[model samples]
Target: MTGLGDSRHVVVVGASLAGTRTAQNLRALGHTGPITLIGAEAELPYDRPPLSKDLLVSDWSDETVEGFRLATSAELDDLNLDLRLGVAATALDPDTRQVTLADGASVDYDVLVIATGAAARPSPWRPASGLLQLRTLSDARAIAARLALREPVVVVGGGFIGTEIAAAAIKLGCPVTVVDPVAEPMTRIVGPEVAGSLVDLHRANGAATRFGVGVVDIRGEAGALTVVLDDGSELTASTAIVGIGSVPGTAWLEGSGLTLDNGVVTDARLRAIGVDDIYAIGDVARWPHPGLGAHRAEHWTNSSDQARFVAAAIAQDAVLEYSSTDYVWSDQYDWKVHTVGWRDPQGSSVLVGDLAADGRVAVVHADADGNACGAVTINWVRALNQARRLLMAGDTAEAIAEQLEQLTVRAA
Candidate 1:
């Protein structure tokens, strides 16, 4: 198979985890062609997961945070990539194979990879000072500085990031409250059983909850913000962190003739629908999964997995249908929550151990047909690994549950 060869120039947008990994993989695969990496932020690519995790809770210096850099200056130089930083892609012209930058300059490419990733969904309530959202390193630094003050904090969402931020704030001895409209905010991701345990864990760690409520308005200045609830109640806090969700960064491809429904719609091979020589990955691409059907994965593992797959595909290597085990994890207090595959709350769930007593439990979920769909385990790394292997091996949910039950009983 003849790869693009050393002649074709590949342009990758978004110098993020997905983008950086893709560029590095391309070089590793012996693609000696000209590779250009573009990023909107001025800083080099860094890990985003730590932005809400260790960066917010610990008093780590900027150098320590730089340890999370995906690629150092030396490594990037070794890759021989034309690194373009602090410039945003304003528009994409598929017909001309050109990408216009924010500086009114355009770059032509033989092949284009859209790994633009996603942006933090802005909160409707914007206070001049205390309101914050964590997406970039800058945002995390601001939140960490505010958390150091140990003032009262109100988190306006109860999703994974919101809950994680709340946990970090609680560690700082700040009175924290998590507000969400849904009863169990993350039930759709980790299923009802595990999400319920998470809520309890937060409460046990001195974090307050305002579940089943929505934010009506945010009033006051930065130092003191009043959060008004839909139920006509109010809570005052020194700072507010919004972790609602994120939207794809595909606005530049608006008139590029590519299908954009929530994200750039791609086929099973990660190729953009209706466009040749263009591929999409990471949070910006909604591709078809064999089990889950069509969906966009926002997890860190998904981004890296897609990057490796796309890199291999571009190098004319053995291309396999993109199939991910779909793993995601969260850290709340001392508990480590891990999940694999898909978890459906409406489906049958088999619980192996007691979440309250053992502090370790695994919930195996099955579809209506009784086939294994996913599993969620709390502080049970062995059980989680076992479930992942069995799920990938086509084991039935009932069969996996029986094995998990035996393991839990033996551990007891």
Candidate 2:
């Protein structure tokens, strides 16, 4: 209502990494306003990246959620935020500046932040049992338990999340099969050159591939489920993970007068278009990029960066437009894959190191005009760091490749 330490009530929907981090950054930026942190899950805000990796591969307990929590009960108390866990924001009235919770109550807010993130796109084929999609801690726990049985696992996508889950299941000694309709699913993101290596990596690690076909229907239940492929083939598995994709968590905002296409469309500053006193971040927000046009990035780094930017604007009236590093990473078996920026198919790419001959490698990508735009590194941290710097600095693709090659030589 007043200034940073005033009595303004800031209600943040979606207690996710983005929501929690926004709250944290607001406090760190000296916003003493009453912040209401709402979440649909009862669990404390924990990191979701591990839901498909560490959480499934390793043995963990219900309490393991706390180990990955972004903040604890004590920390929330220290920040003096009103904790509204296990209840979702069912309705939002931007005109009235009020949030209607599922608990039949309403809270007035001077400012509202939407960071609900996303939910795994629901599987069209739902059997009586044995179908799972990893998007939350509970989902991860259930999936971990299923994989622990060391039975067959059919991951219904070859994208990063699905592949990561498949890797986890394979590591647990489960016979795994990755099913995808898009033959080379990663071609759009990582290009065909790298996608081939990824396919090899999966085969090298003992994960089966059923690409170029999709599951038309699934029958039976866990431990006896039958995956019916569109090509009239069938694969029996103990469990099936449908990681085809995800949808932005915007169902609750349907009648809230907010524009939602793929997500909450925002301006350059991430403020919800056509509304004042409201902002959207994380997977739920699709903001414009100076170079890449408008799109939503589900990467963890984007969430962190957007949260801090929005908090600074609210706390200090900051004017700098938000710019993302566009960074992402994944762990499949023993490989550590890191990607910086987007890969342009129309542009050219330069391979710096040999992944087969060498243990690590880097692929530098350039735009049509030869400006370095992106890089992908496998098990090579130094190359990743250098790639990030060079790409961010707008180095030529050739320049990036040369420098990475020099670094490779030095390491050798």
List lDDT for all candidates, in order.
0.89, 0.89
Residue-level lDDT of model 1, residues 1-412, one tens digit each, is: 3475656788999999999999999998888888999999999999999888887776687688878899999999999999999999989999999999998989999888999999999889877779999899999989988998999999998988999899899888899999999988888888887788788888889988999999999878777899999999999999999988999999999988999998999988898997768999999999998667788899999999999888888876546778886999988778888989986545798888888888899999998777899999999999999999999888998899889888877876
Against the true structure, what is each candidate's TM-score?
A: 0.97, 0.97
Clashing residue pairs found in predicted model 1: 130-222
- Residue 351 shift from truth in candidate 1, angstroms: 0.9
Candidate 2, overall lDDT? 0.89
- Per-residue accuracy of model 2 over 130-181 as CA lDDT, tens digit each: 9999899889989988988999999998999999998889888899999999
